[model samples]
Target: MSRTNIDIDDELVTMAMRLYNLRTKREAVNYALRQLVGDPMTLEEALAMKGVGWEGDLDAIKGGGPIEDLDDIDLDLLPQDLGDLDARDDR
Candidate 1:
């Protein structure tokens, strides 16, 4: 592999390390780069993933069942605050 020095965002690297649970900066960067542009699995490997003991009903989860009308929803039951995000002054 060719080694090169390049500038990268520290915050992004930290986030990637935490998200992927990688032990090193090299591992984190490699994982992130693979995710962005690499498909390490072959077609046979990808096709093999089907019916590999996954018990969940994929069709039901993909909206194959009957859909409910929005009017049927109770607005009062919804959570008031989505998250405690800081208000942006840029707005």
Candidate 2:
């Protein structure tokens, strides 16, 4: 590791320390850098990993198939009243 002087925000460092559970500023900085620079993945790897456990229909999206529109939903089937949502009678 090479030693270098750089200006960093105190609030950001403290936040990173709490989020990453790091003790020192150095550890927090390193963890934050690693998070910013994530591991690279190829398109083939990403596509191959798709539909592992997904239950949705892939054919609907593929071959430019007709997409379902949600604008024709029946709102009357929904509940009319939410009972006892707020028990506290403070006005």
| TM-score of each candidate structure, all chains considered together | 0.43, 0.42
**Per-residue lDDT tens digits of candidate 2, residues 45-85?**
46756666555444443435443666544445444464666
Tens digit of per-residue lDDT, candidate 1, span 1-91: 8897889878878987786567888988877777669758657546756765555455544455454776654455554564545643423
Q: Report the Cα lDDT for residue 30, model 1.
A: 79
Each prediction's RMSD to truth: 8.3, 13.2
Consecutive 10-residue window with the lowest summed lDDT within model 2: 58-67
Query: The CA-based lDDT of model 2 is what?
Result: 0.65
> In terms of TM-score, which candidate is strongest?
1
Q: How does each model score on lDDT?
A: 0.66, 0.65
**Which regions of candidate 1 are displaced past 4 Å?**
40-91
Q: By lDDT, who's the top model here? A: 1
* lDDT over C-alpha atoms for residue 78 of model 2: 42
Q: Judge candidate 1 against the unseen true structure and give its global Cα lDDT, from 0 to 1.
A: 0.66
